[model samples]
Target: MRISDIPVPDTTAARGALALATEYQTPALTAHALRSWLWAEAFALVDGVTGVDRELLYVSAVLHDIGTVTEFDNHSLSYEHAGGHVGIALTAGAGWARERRHRVLDVIVRHNWPSVDPSMDAEGHLLETATALDISGSRPGDLPEVFVREVLAAHPRGALAAEFGACVVDQASRKPDTAARRLVDGGVVAKLAANPLELL
Candidate 1:
């Protein structure tokens, strides 16, 4: 479903998400863009795997990290609670169907357990990989080769995580040259300051 058609989460939930992102030191712009793109990607994958509604899946993915904004330590539990909160708020505001709400919660809850759960769907797998990649930065010197060679190479989830992490870092930096510059400058401050929109 189109993003426009999806109902926005409540003000409190949105603020909570932003707060959690700040606490986690999530780059504001990156998180905003990443959430949108990630949801779109997750929806596509989920739709392909299950006959579930893409819009519902997108909603779940977009708000999955809300509890992270709170004090939730376990991502899986945080996601589940966040999903419930969003679902309840959406139901009240948009009059969503019970089945659709359940679907959204199921997807959100499964998203944080890709590595440990064999029953994860494509959307869940994609979300897990994308989140891992974001947490593991992609700058030139930031690439953990040992993780790739020794850890991820044997695991599908791990390997995909590394690949997506690299791609996200590359995309975030604009180019390999930019990555080199970022490494030299000690961070992406200069490059990003020069081209703010590039990050989005």
Candidate 2:
């Protein structure tokens, strides 16, 4: 489904989460986050994945990279780790039960991984795949061209490539043991080079 067609939940907590993400994240990251959620939702609709908690998915998508913001990057934690913590904290105030809150945390933490088995959690799996498609341009055929065009038209990529690359490189430099560093050492550059997307 197109993002315009899918209604984002109108809960007060959802609004607060979006505002917080907008306040902290860079413009590129904000756009990426929204696009990630849209891509995930689109894939889910095509695949007939059901029972997704739309609010949690939206919040998780928006806050997935929150740790990249300087205010949240005070420690040596990987951006994913920090982002997961932030997600938990943000949802805790929303009065979610412990189990539901942790599910959101799982989505944020697992999104950085190379793959997410759908059996684990449909939302996380969708978010992970969507992130990969957005960043590495993997599985371009999985999404319709019209949907892709609509998404990009709504949220232009602009400097997302350079901005995201620099963020990951900087994280790798700061914390060699981080996933960012591992990805870099494991040939992320080569992967990006092979990506068909015109990231520039």
Candidate 3:
């Protein structure tokens, strides 16, 4: 079940996405973004999914957690919303058309949703599923051990759980009405603590 390779798109948007992630995100968070994209690629390979825009998915994955970064954390906006806007700006600067740029925003925002219908947005579905696998260990057995190992070897989870846990906790404390609060209340910390990827 392991994919032999996890492709990284070589395009203006993809390059800008990684650069922005590296500049704004901690090394751990940047790795999480990279891992998220790797996971998305794995899913696409295994599931034989087609018609996804690779550049858009890659950019969205790189920027999905951007709101957790300090420079972008000053707003009262929920992290997903803030991250989505950052995605919008990045896509715009990459010369993406407005329609495709909005897809970047949509994908980033929906990645945090509990479920995303693939028929509605294939990239969003892949990202939501990928981030869920990375963050909370959802669908734990769906990804093969070999694939997971390859991704970890490339990215090394590092302190992603601790750093992201703290960031979400802080967001929850400040924005009680947001999904961060819901996730904290729903035991995301414990899930992070128990994530098999961390143990892997």
My TM-score estimates for the predictions, one after another, are 0.42, 0.92, 0.95
Candidates in order have lDDT scores of 0.42, 0.82, 0.87
Per-residue lDDT over 1-200 for candidate 2, one digit per residue giving the tens place of the 0 to 100 score:
46579788898657867898889887878888998999899988887888888998998998888888899984688998888788788788888788988887799888888788887788898899888887888788888887888888887776777788888888899988888997777766566555555542
lDDT of 3 by residue, 1-200 (tens): 44345567888888988988999899999999989988887788777778999888899999999988888874688898888898888778889899999998799889988889888999999999999988998876777787788789979999988999998999999988888998899888888888988888
- The residue pairs that clash in candidate 3, if any, are none
Model 2: worst 10 consecutive residues (lDDT sum): 191-200
Q: Please list all clashing residue pairs in model 2, or write none if there are none.
A: none
Model 2 segments more than 4 A misplaced: 189-195
Of 1 and 2, the candidate ranking higher by lDDT: 2
Ranking by TM-score: 3, 2, 1
The CA lDDT at 23 in model 1 is: 54
Q: Is candidate 1 or candidate 2 better by TM-score?
A: 2
Residues 133-174, candidate 1: write the lDDT tens digits. 443232212223443332222222222223323433443344
